[model samples]
Target: MADYLGMLKGEQLVSLSENFDYVTATADFVGLKLFPAVKTDNMKLAIAQLTKGGKIPVMALVHALDTEARIGDRPNYETMNVELMLIKEKLNQGEAIRKLIRDTGMKETESEILKAVFNDANNLISRVLTRVEGM
Candidate 1:
């Protein structure tokens, strides 16, 4: 398996843990191009070095996107707000939620619930990102 370095918005850098096939699947699921570069022998060290000066990790950013999709209730969203805020700069929260819905292969009738989820996730992500940016 080959490891590749992926960058989002030029600031967020992710280390692809899988080979080409799995990387493609992950990128499609996340709706991000994730431009790949040369592989690093020690990704953790590379990430730490790259993110020096208080920068966040790419894995943490990916977790934020995943969190938005899994947040089912107000309490969950509230609890995970800090984690989500870290990746606000890396992705468009609304778009990421919508892409997740579209990628789920759901039927039209079920879209109502999906739309609601998308809206909720979008609102939560937007609010948290805004708050984090202002801080």
Candidate 2:
């Protein structure tokens, strides 16, 4: 089994597997080029193999592409690292959305909605952290 990264794009979930076979199979079935996390040389070979196996290459060249060929926004690692650090700093300082909302004197309904949003965001962050730790 391969550890696949799944990105949500609108109503579709685009999954990219680390395994070359898995990616090739997916591409063969869906008629989409699923990029694999491999060296440029290997990637080129994989692309050629997939094409030879009757899978249409959605992307021209794996090494030449600036970003991953997918429907969703590619994750910016640098931005994510900076934002994670900022979130940690804020948490350590006891800063939270509820406090900000209270300080700003938001209306009751608006405050509730903001609180819910923040709660969901925190949960998502926690889940991400857990996954990272497991890795």
Candidate 3:
């Protein structure tokens, strides 16, 4: 069985991969040509986190994106949410996540931080809690 970053059972990961195969594949195909480094870094973080935990780093990515959106000209909230959801789904699949990250070309430390951010569900929840508390 593929290690899938050592995060999930092979069967589970495969099922998740199948569920979002089309989007993931297309994203990868486009990402390779259009936004190589960025896509690669995101996927790498996703897979590494999954290997260490069993899920994607959804919350962190969402938070990061939210911050980015806020700093820039924000788009419609729902649209951004949808985009993030697709990204989250892509991150859940080991192979897809691996390919995305590999194609992006992120540094080791950036990958490490992403993996650490999503090391476990609780960690993600805690981050949310902290952010909420601050707000």
Candidate 4:
């Protein structure tokens, strides 16, 4: 992400993680796309404590879009499709939660999580179902 963020001459770098929980959780918020080319709302931010990267529940907070101070080719940045991202989040989240329940030996209870995870995905998926499904 450091490259995408375009940081030159700095030790601080950014990298996107493979955890959908991060992205799925962000579906509930807002994100401002500084780049005009990208289309989406509710900026998503996923962060974890590097101090104990793999030892705790991941932490992420995204409430601002202030990058004016940073210098780079941000004016010509590319963005990801927020709609497709919904599919990734919903499917992956459902899988992960199920896996946790099955493998962690956690006592299972009423789980509305999957429903909630795919809550707003219907419209996003329906919009391109035919194309995606080859139907």
Q: Between prediction 1 and prediction 4, which has the larger lDDT? A: 4
lDDT for each residue of candidate 4 in 1-135, tens digit (9 for 90 to 100)? 112123112232111222224334433322212221245575664443334234445434444576444332212233434323332322334456555545654335223432333343453443334333442
lDDT of 2: 0.35
My TM-score estimates for the predictions, one after another, are 0.21, 0.21, 0.18, 0.18
**Leading candidate by lDDT:** 3
Q: Write candidate 3's Cα lDDT for 30-125 as tens digits.
A: 334553333332322221122333343433324654355434322222211112222121124356555544565435544453443234444433
Query: Which pairs of residues have clashing backbones in candidate 1?
Result: none
For TM-score, candidate 2 versus 3, the one ahead is 2
Off by over 4 Å in 4: 1-95, 103-109, 117-123, 126-135
**Clashing residue pairs, candidate 3?**
5-51, 7-51, 40-101, 40-104, 44-101
Off by over 4 Å in 1: 1-109
Clashes of each: 0, 0, 5, 4
Model 1 has a clash total of: 0
- Writing each residue's lDDT as its tens digit, candidate 2 over 1-135 gives 011102112222122112124332333322123323332322122111222324333445444557666453333222111112212412222346446445655455553543344344355455444444444
Candidate 1: 10-residue stretch with minimal lDDT? 1-10
Candidate 2, pairs of clashing residues: none
Cand. 4 TM to true fold? 0.18
Provide the lDDT at 34 for model 2. 36
List candidate 2 segments past 4 Å from native: 1-107
